[model samples]
Target: MIERTVKYKKPSPKPEKNRDVRLPRLYKSLYDQIINNHYKNALKTVNKLQRLDTDNEELIKTRIFILLQLDQFSHASSLIQSSSQPFAYEHAYTNYRLKNEHLASQSISPDSDDRKWKILSAQLLYRQGDYKSAIDLYESLMSDLSPDTDEYTDLETNLKASKECLDFHRHGYLQAMDELNVPPLDVLENNPAPFPDNYKPPAIDTSSVTVSSATTETPSKLLKQKEKRRAAMHSKHANKNMQIDPERWLPMKERSYYRKPRQQMSINHKRR
Candidate 1:
């Protein structure tokens, strides 16, 4: 035995917890994009993070939400199905957005302690046209969420939309006009001008509105795309209106299948 005691190999020390191989800056950027409603950019960041932290539950949830926001429902649905362990709320939400209501209801955890699941349930109810149920659920859930949180803000917004949808479903456009004490545009356009001859609407003051350098400069690619969408929508709407035979309103019996309602026409006109 030339050397009975061989040199022992020392084990390497574990890296510090804070020194984990995660792109914290990129994660923060993803969060910032989500908060700013930049879902397209957020989706891109999610792919980057997945390369590093594939098992992060929050990232998976966020990626599903971003996909939904981007109207990539097929991708969202596939993601939900493929995820090893999807969050109940996110799974329910993605299913709801994909119009799989039955599946969405099944995914919801009745015993879930998370307030976000309740919010998703309410949202599903709203989408199902159960506005009253959604409203009640929202009211109940409101007590659990802090008013300062973004979740609460979103809940409030959904509540408002549910109420609006309920009202629209219950009351016809004519009834809404009566309730609001506003003249319907078709009536106004068909009849004489409400104001006296030579009466002009007051000119809006443009002095208070100053165009910033950013506004004057060429728009960003994203903004330009948005503008293009708006332009296309405006053009399509204009073409539809031009094709409408204002002189002959479609018969009530045929309206459901063949004609767009006068109220819709008025609404579209106002959108211009």
Candidate 2:
């Protein structure tokens, strides 16, 4: 048996690492756009990044964030749904923005440590007329948040608003208004008068009224009116003739009104 030499084939370099070389540059551009509040441009960059790395969870999150910044809650919600990674806070927030209270409440993780989730929960409670719960959440947030920050200030305002809403709902002010038979300001503004839909205005009886001879126009009065109209026409024609100027239709600069003193006819021409 003759021994045959077996040649080994060299392995080719993987192109996967080379293809990712542009990813960092794209990421930097995306971050720059986001930082400058250019969400529309950031969204475009995010799309390009997604195409390059379809399975990147961070890219999906970034794209969803950009969509939210652009107020595209529907698109963000759909993206969240299609994504395998769970975006509990984003999903809840998108549902909240969309006014889907049930979905928002269901998706929100109340026990999460994220402050934004708590704020969203409080807002949802307030929307649901649970002002007491909202107030409690806002108070807790106020205690934890630093007083110097804008978030703390906003929370303070929300807490006060929640307290006011709670007081309005719990107090007898609405009952008093109802007892007094007074409509709310919104009702008064929207419908100033509660006229019946089927009600019709009374018809005027013109047949019963007669035109008196004194109010009727006589032949002499008709002649006088004709004379006045003739006089008006004559006066109008006279005024038109008097005001007529040959240069009236000319360009402003070429008109007599704009003529130079030296360009105007001299005293000899005027005399002629």
**Best by the lDDT measure:** 2
Candidate 2 stretches greater than 4 Å from native: 1-21, 182-272
Which stretches in model 1 have alpha-carbon errors above 4 Å? 1-38, 52-62, 143-272
The 10 consecutive residues of candidate 1 with the worst lDDT sum are: 235-244
lDDT of 1: 0.81
TM-score of each: 0.42, 0.60
For model 1 the TM-score comes to 0.42
Give lDDT: candidate 1, residue 141: 86
**C-alpha RMSD between model 2 and the true structure:** 18.2
The sequence of per-residue lDDT tens digits that candidate 2 reaches over residues 1-272 is 97769978899986665656889998899989999999999999988888888877888888888899999999999999998888888998999999999999998876787888889999999999999999988888888668999999898888888899889978888888778967688989998686799999999999999988756888899899888988877655366447668887889887766855653668657778
Candidate 1 lDDT over residue span 1-272, tens digit each: 57667888899997754525458788789879989999888888889888778777888878887987888888887887898874566667767877899999998877887777877788778888899999999989887779999878988998999999999878787676668966778987899856688888899999898887765666586689788887877655366445666536767666545767799999999999
